[model samples]
Target: MKITSTKLIAATVLAMFFVNNSAKAQSLPESKLKFGIGLDGILPVGNLTNTANFGLGLTPRLQYGVSENVAVTFTTGIYHFFTKEIRIPSGLPGQYNTMENKLDLIPVKAGVKSFVSSNVYFSGEIGVALQVDNGGGGSQFIASPGVGYAGDKWDLGVRYENLSKTGSNSAGFIGLRLAYGFGL
Candidate 1:
């Protein structure tokens, strides 16, 4: 019989790799279908000045499992913001009316969620947003990053989103969400 140091080292590394992977596999959730809805409250920043101040919105999501701990998500949401109001001449003489400032955003995105632990996860999304207001409407690119705790039937998370407009400026906000889902 013979024993070598290099062989022993290689064997140890291989064993450790398998043990780590098995532990991760054990913590992964089973694949299934899930649906959830959430709400977001945001404060505008950067290029969104004058056009947006504060916002509140709703998000509805559908997720389909691809692996034990991985899922593909389809999401859409809308946010409303009150910006700056301007005074305009009313139809009657010597009368001025204040125009209300409101901006609405609708985003549709496809994303992937990966569970890193039994109850912890991270996700990223890229999509397009339809921006509408009293003046005119346009579309822009949107990106989002999120992290949260997920359970068997519910989850809570926080996300930061960036909406890039055609011009030089961009709009962004941070939001919190609580969602519930069921397996099928």
Candidate 2:
């Protein structure tokens, strides 16, 4: 059976909601602020895999608890995608030359995190990603959904991030983030 993207996303959200409802309730600090820095490893997917081999990112985030199990967040980050070498035809039959390409992006986002358990949470974010290149690149809209484990001082999460631009194909990646966090 073929599963569409919309269906998959809906299923994931539904599953997370069920998990949250079934898990034993835990208390979270209210009206408290926390800061975190995360290092990410990304694997290109969809059309992005055609050009990029892998990616790395650094992100800093701030979270403010609004309720016992919910928090609002702001995140900004830099991501660099390493591109594969491509061969270009050299104006002659059976002759070619290779060139390398790369991409850098900076993202600004706002999101919400809802705890499912004492250490598990589900998060969703939406924002814009600005491209950085010699050609003066443009920006794309970004949306990401993730699930994570947050401990006293360490957090780990996995997310699927999608970026869309006008007049171009959308790109995506699966990312894993390891973070260190503290109260502020």
- Strongest candidate by lDDT: 2
Worst lDDT run of 10 residues, candidate 2, spans 19-28
Candidate 1 off by > 4 Å = 1-31, 86-99
**Model 1 lDDT tens row, 27-108:** 2245667788877777776667666677888888888877766678889988887677767899899999997767887889
Clash count per candidate:
0, 0
Q: Supply the global lDDT for candidate 1.
A: 0.71
Q: Number of clashes in model 1?
A: 0
Error of 2 at 184 (Å): 1.0
Residue range 14-95, candidate 2, lDDT tens digits: 7555665554443337898999999999999899999999999999999888877778889998999998998999999999
Please estimate how well model 2 matches the true structure, expressed as its whole-model Cα lDDT.
0.84
State the lDDT at 138 in candidate 2. 88
